[model samples]
Target: MIVLAILTGVLTGILSGLLGIGGGAIFVVAAVFFLGVPQHAAQAAAIAAMIPTAIVGVVKHHRNRLIDYRYLPYLAAGIILGGMVGAYVANITADIVLRRLFSAFFALMSIQMFWSSFRQGRKAPAKQQDHDKH
Candidate 1:
């Protein structure tokens, strides 16, 4: 169990570095499958773990000029509104239904991200045209 946790953490750290994302998904899976944690508790633990990881990541990205802090207000507004609605719905929903819904939501988002990245990879950036304005 301890070895599994250590291996999971190592894999998650590598994935997080490669993808530029927090290891929330990996943490959730590990907690539920390996640690025998409840789904909701796993989700909460995953989120809590993300706090410090995200802070350090943000610092690194900011140093690299990868962060556009100007858009934070928009991001925060959406997050706050969506979080409230999600929490309310989750509290009122049945466990099985919530689980299915969350699974579907994650699947859809993963597909979208995959497709966007694939398309971006196939496209070439616009080149300067000779007919364009000087």
Candidate 2:
């Protein structure tokens, strides 16, 4: 079980880095489906796990000069406040409702990503032509 959890964390971390996503998406689903954890518990665990992973990511990006420090205060404030609100809401929500909400959120995000990718693909030809004219 420990080994499985570790593997899940490793995979989640890799996906987070590759996709520029918080690991909660991967971690929650993996914990619930693969690890047989309860949905609410899984979400709580994922949120807890993200702290260290996010810190490391931020540090690496900061070192590479990829972060805009100017936005940190605003972003941090929003995150802290939003996290409190979300945690409170989640605690009051039914487990099944939370699960459905999470699933719907992922589905919508996937659709949006596909649509964005398609739009980018459509513009690529025009972009290439403009580049050639330069």
Candidate 1: list runs displaced more than 4 Å.
110-134
TM-score of each: 0.70, 0.89
What's the number of clashes in each of the models?
0, 0
So what's the TM-score on candidate 2? 0.89
Best by lDDT: 2
CA RMSD for every model?
5.7, 3.0
Global lDDT of each candidate: 0.77, 0.92
Q: Which residue pairs show collisions in model 1?
A: none
Report the lDDT tens digits of candidate 1 across residue range 17-81: 89866687777777777888777776667767777887887899899999888999999899889
Point out where model 2 deviates above 4 Å: 125-134
